[model samples]
Target: MIATRDAYGEALAKLGEENDNIVVLDADLSGSTKTSLFAKKFPERFFNMGIAEANMIGTAAGLAAAGKIPFASTFAIFAVGRAWEQVRQSVAYPKANVKIVATHSGITVGEDGGSHQSVEDIAIMRAVPNMTVIVPADGIETALAVKAAADFKGPVYVRLGRNKVPTIFDDTYKFEIGKGVMLRPGTDITFIGTGLMTAQALVAADLLQAEGISARVIHIATIKPLDEEIILAAARETGAIVTAEEHSIIGGLGGAVSELLSEKCPTKLKRVGIKDRFGLSGKGDELLKYFGLLPENLVEAAKEILAEK
Candidate 1:
């Protein structure tokens, strides 16, 4: 198992070798955010902006204006919450080629409590006009996402977690900005998931298979600019939908899928995520299970949705 933030740091370091225009910026959490690895590799190109997230974001914007591909790293709460106005006014407004890779997002930043955790980051980022929002499933997907974000020209927000997670993708996996990948094929019901919840969805599929139920599993890596075509196809085929994410159901992955289906397909759907509540401090796995984001919870949701169908 590997943490996505670990893959992010390694990917940024490798990208530095390939592109000379690439630079890294961090607020005070380089060690936790793992951007310190890049700083070690390229001291000249790394900028430690201290504990000032707003300043760090503005500095990244300036670097983008100077034709540098700046990657800003920090905790999700500070990156989005503390410096939201700066990010909105500076980088995203200009459509800068700045990558904001935030680690320890959602309820997985265990033991940090609700104040440090960020459940609204994805929602706010998706609301921005020119920003691209992505939440990779695992370390392998995180590497691919970092590389893809670098090549794409725009403001990108990549959300990663702190704990090590099961690898869902291999070396052959290809990640597109606004495309969903189907991991398993089924006709009874469809499970659309993002982040670590995608792994749980796969597990739920296995459990359902034992009960003679065919469940289709689709991983949505890109939250904003969602793959509506793929989702609509799934709704047309499966007839029922269940969305899982390591975020609140209000305005995250669940909300995005709900909006899409309501406008286009209008199918029976169930969302598996935090029920618009704040996360408490605990172990990552425990918090996930407590919030009903486990495979068993997904199985129950699928069965309930299937019964309605």
Candidate 2:
């Protein structure tokens, strides 16, 4: 198991070696955000912008305009909450090649409490125009997504977790910008998951299989430009859907899937996520279980949705 932030740091360092134009800016959080690895390797290419998150974003935008691929790093709450206007006007509006790779996202930001945890980052970033939002499930996917964001031109927001999560993919796995991968296949129900929840969805599928319930698991790495085709097909074929994410049910993966399915194909759905509330200070795994974000929660949601179906 490895924290996605650790993978991001290693990937950014490797990317620095490959591309001279790749520059990194961090808001006084190089150590926590793991951009410190890049700083250690290529100090010239890295700029520690102090505690000013908004200024860091603007600087990154300027660097992007100067024909450089700038990656801005910080905590998810500060990146999306504090520097939202700069992100919207300076980066997204002009479609600058600024990659806002935020770490310590979601309730996994443990012990920092609700003020630091960013459960609503995905919702707000997803709402921004010209912003591509990604929530990679594990380290392998995080590395692939980081490379993909660096390659693609435009504003991108990649949300990463603080805690070490189970590795869900290997070298054989292929990662795309706007694609969903089906990890497990089933006919009865589908669990559409993003971020750390994807790993839990797979566990839930296994648990369900033992109980004679065939549950399909789909991992959605990209939140914006959602894989509508895959979701629609899952809804049409399975007749039931459950969305799990380390975010609010409102305007996150659950909201996106609900909107798509409601318009295109109405399917019985259940969302397993934070229920419009702030995070509490606690251990990461305990918080996940406390908020019903474990595999058992997905199992319960699946059974409920299947019963309705």
Model 1 vs. true fold: TM: 0.99
Every candidate's CA RMSD: 0.7, 0.5
Question: Which sections of candidate 1 miss by over 4 Å?
Answer: none
Tens digit of lDDT per residue, candidate 2, span 160-266?
A: 99999999899999999999999989999999999999999999999999999999899999999999999999999999999999999999999999999999999
Weakest 10 consecutive residues of candidate 1 by summed lDDT: 116-125
Please provide, for model 1 over 113-230, each residue's C-alpha lDDT reduced to its tens digit, 9 standing for 90 to 100: 9998888888888888898999999999999999999999999999999999999899999899999999999999999999999999999999999999999999999998899999
Error of 1 at 2 (Å): 0.4
Cα lDDT computed for each candidate against the true fold = 0.94, 0.96
* Every model's TM-score: 0.99, 0.99
Clash totals in order: 0, 0
- Looking at candidate 2, the ten consecutive residues that score lowest on lDDT are 300-309
Model number with the top TM-score: 2
